[model samples]
Target: MSSLLGSKEATNRSFRSIADLTVLGLLTLLLAALPLGASGYVLYVVNLLMVYVVLSLGMHLAIGETGQFTLSHTAFFGIGIYTAGLVNNHWHFPFPVSILASAAVAALVGWVIGVLALRMRDIYLALATFAFGEAMQWVLLNWESVTRGANGLRFRAATLGELQLVSDLLAYPFVVAIAALMMALTFAITRSRLGLAFRAVRESDMAAVAMGINARAIKVTSFVLSAAFAGVAGGMYTLFTSFIHPESLGFETTVMVLTMVVVGGLGSVRGAVAGAIIVGLISELLRQAPSYQEIIYGVILMLFMMFLPKGLASLVNGRVALKKGCAS
Candidate 1:
């Protein structure tokens, strides 16, 4: 029985590795090929989708992995954007430095929210995070002295030594590279022992604690990881785009990313990536029709929830399971 179980585990690991490589290979190929003849608008849209991908991946870590219903992703994202943009605006350092600073600052703020999350659960935890998100947006809106208030903050082009990212075409490669890196990192984290602890705690903190998993620490770590991803994503945004508004970092943005994670399958990394791209494109396409956008988006959400609550990942899983059963 032990040998059989070990064999089964090994097979599953192989299957997972193949699936991850297939997804990453496809995504990398798709993004990599876009630069050949893609227009500026196409480049911009893809860059924005990459940012959404990172944000959704982060959301998955908290709500999907650790089962923490924190709504502070947008807040962390805003923290990253302002931090990266402001640092670039004021300093002459390389843009990578500014982006790293953004990630550090966002992670620090996320840590505070994570500590606060220890005392709460479910809706209360979500509400607290959401409230914090709102407060941060307010700061971006009213802090005219530094943030330039409601007018929006526009910074200069990002630089790396002598190279300046003055156009979307120039920035596309870096954005794609970073997004790919984040996607691979997410997959790596999910397969690690730390990820095992995250899901264990998600199942039940009591059970995780019994197994010596340090549930509290796991929860905090999930939040930190999520925030850092959002921070990096915000930095990526600064690579192609120079201006940001508080309106762009509001609760609605969080909801959109949460939708991508949920619609893709909460705990599935492939689901997160695929969901972000598919659903984000739909959202972007609908921007031209402002009046019916919300209505259409609402209908799509309802349809998915009613018919495919487990998300697109479940469909793939079902097919894989069926094949295995047939072979057996």
Candidate 2:
């Protein structure tokens, strides 16, 4: 009976996995075909959605998997944007090179923040990171020489050799590819031994240490990796956007990413992706109604929190389990 039950359970899981992959494949096909018939505005929105997906995934790594409350994600994202934008604007380097430079610069800054995190936890860590984010915003706003201060920094078109990407359609393919790569990387990391260590640390650092895991190292590595993800998202942003303002890289942006991760189902990868897409679309749609936007957005969030606290994934999982139970 035990073996029979185990086999049945495995079969159910296999079916669920297959269903998920089928859905994902269909979505990818649809998205790939979008540019063929869609308007430039549609492609632009999709590209922006992909960037949010990457950004939310980064937040998920730090807060959900590693159990770190990091409020400085936008700061690292800003670091990436500025780094990539400046490099491309000055040298007209290829997009790949600029993206890599952005990731490295953001990772380096993340390391410093991670070291600071080692000495604090909970609210103290949150406050410290929040302060750091605000400080970075200030620097971006006041540093008129490099960031162009309040006037914003505009970049020349990103290019590949002689092919200049002058429109959203031109950049869409690269944006989608990079976002897919980040998603795959996130999945791989979450399924590895290091991912187990991250979960263990999240559950109990003391217990993880007792089990011979280097809790401190895992924490710091999480920060670094998360920041790198945000950096890549920023790099992706520069691919399509011509101008970036310092005002856009502040607490409000961080809050939006946090909302994406939390509303998507905290630690679940599917949740993060779905949340980003859904929220991104809603945000874009709401732009048409500027006056009621905040009110409607807040109400939707409040309803979600009150009704589906565990997130959209939980609601879907609940239905799946219910069906299984009914079948049994």
Candidate 3:
């Protein structure tokens, strides 16, 4: 019976793995084909959606997997934007260079914050991160020489030799490619030993420590990874937008990212991506009804939490489970 149970579990794992590969393969095909006939506005919207996917994945790593409650996602995102934009503007480095630098700088800052805030937990941790975000925004607003003080920073077009990504259509393929790469990386991480450590810490730091895990280190690692992903998202933003200001990087942006992760189902990478695409498009459409946008969005989120708290991913899981049971 024990052997039979083990075989069943192995078969289930195989099924999930095959399903994941199929979905990813189809997605890659779409991303590779999208820019062929897409309009300028469609490409622009898709670019932002990809950015949100990266941001939500970052949040999932930190909060969903590591159980860290941080409200400073946009702060790291802003850091990435400015770092990549400034580098591209001043040094004319390739987009990859600027993006990597942004990730490194953001990870460094996240490490600092994680070290300082590790002592706190729950609401205290959230508040502390929120305060840090507000402070970062203030700096972006007041740093006249650096951020251009509310006028917005207009960076040079991201370039790789003769290939210049000035327009949304021009940058669409790269943007989608980067976002897909991040998704694949996230999947790989969640299947590795480090991912097991993250989940153990998330379940209970004290229990994880008792089991010989360096829970604190895992938490800090999550923070750094989360920030790096956000920073990359920011760099992706610079590729097409070419301009940014303090106003766009605020707590609301953080809230939207948080919402995406939660609505997609916490701790599920597939959910985060789907949530980003669905919620990102909805948020974009909500712009037309600025006054009622918040109300409608809030209602939708509340309803999801109330009825489908496990998120859209839960439905997929249910279907998979049903199939597995039928096979058994």
Q: Which ten residues in a row have the lowest lDDT in candidate 1?
A: 290-299
Model 2, residue pairs in steric clash? none
166-247, model 2: which lDDT tens digit per residue?
9999999999999999999999999999999999999999999999999999999999999999999999999999999998
Judged by lDDT against the true structure, how good is candidate 3? 0.91
Alpha-carbon shift of residue 237 in model 3 (angstroms): 0.7
Tens digits of lDDT, candidate 1, 1-328: 8787678768976997898789768867877788998999999999899999998999999988899988889999999999999999998678889889988999898898889865799999988998999999999999999999999999989999999999999998988888888988998999999999999999999999999888888999999999999999999999999899998787667777878887899789989988899889988988887567556666766877899988899998998788666745
List ranges where model 1 is wrong by over 4 Å.
1-16, 19-23, 291-295
Task: Record all residue pairs in model 3 with backbone atoms less than 3 Å apart, i.e. clashing.
Answer: none
Ranking by TM-score: 3, 2, 1
Output candidate 1 Cα RMSD: 1.9
> What number of backbone clashes does candidate 1 have, counting pairs of residues 3 or more apart or in separate chains?
0
Q: Candidate 3: where is the Cα deviation over 4 Å? A: 326-328
RMSD for each model, in Å, please? 1.9, 1.7, 1.5
Q: Please write out the lDDT profile of model 3 over residues 62-179, one tens digit for every residue.
A: 9888999899999999999999999998899999999999999999999999999877999999999999999999999999898997898899999988999979988988898899
- How does each model score on lDDT? 0.88, 0.90, 0.91
TM-score of 3: 0.95
- Which has the higher TM-score value, candidate number 1 or candidate number 3? 3
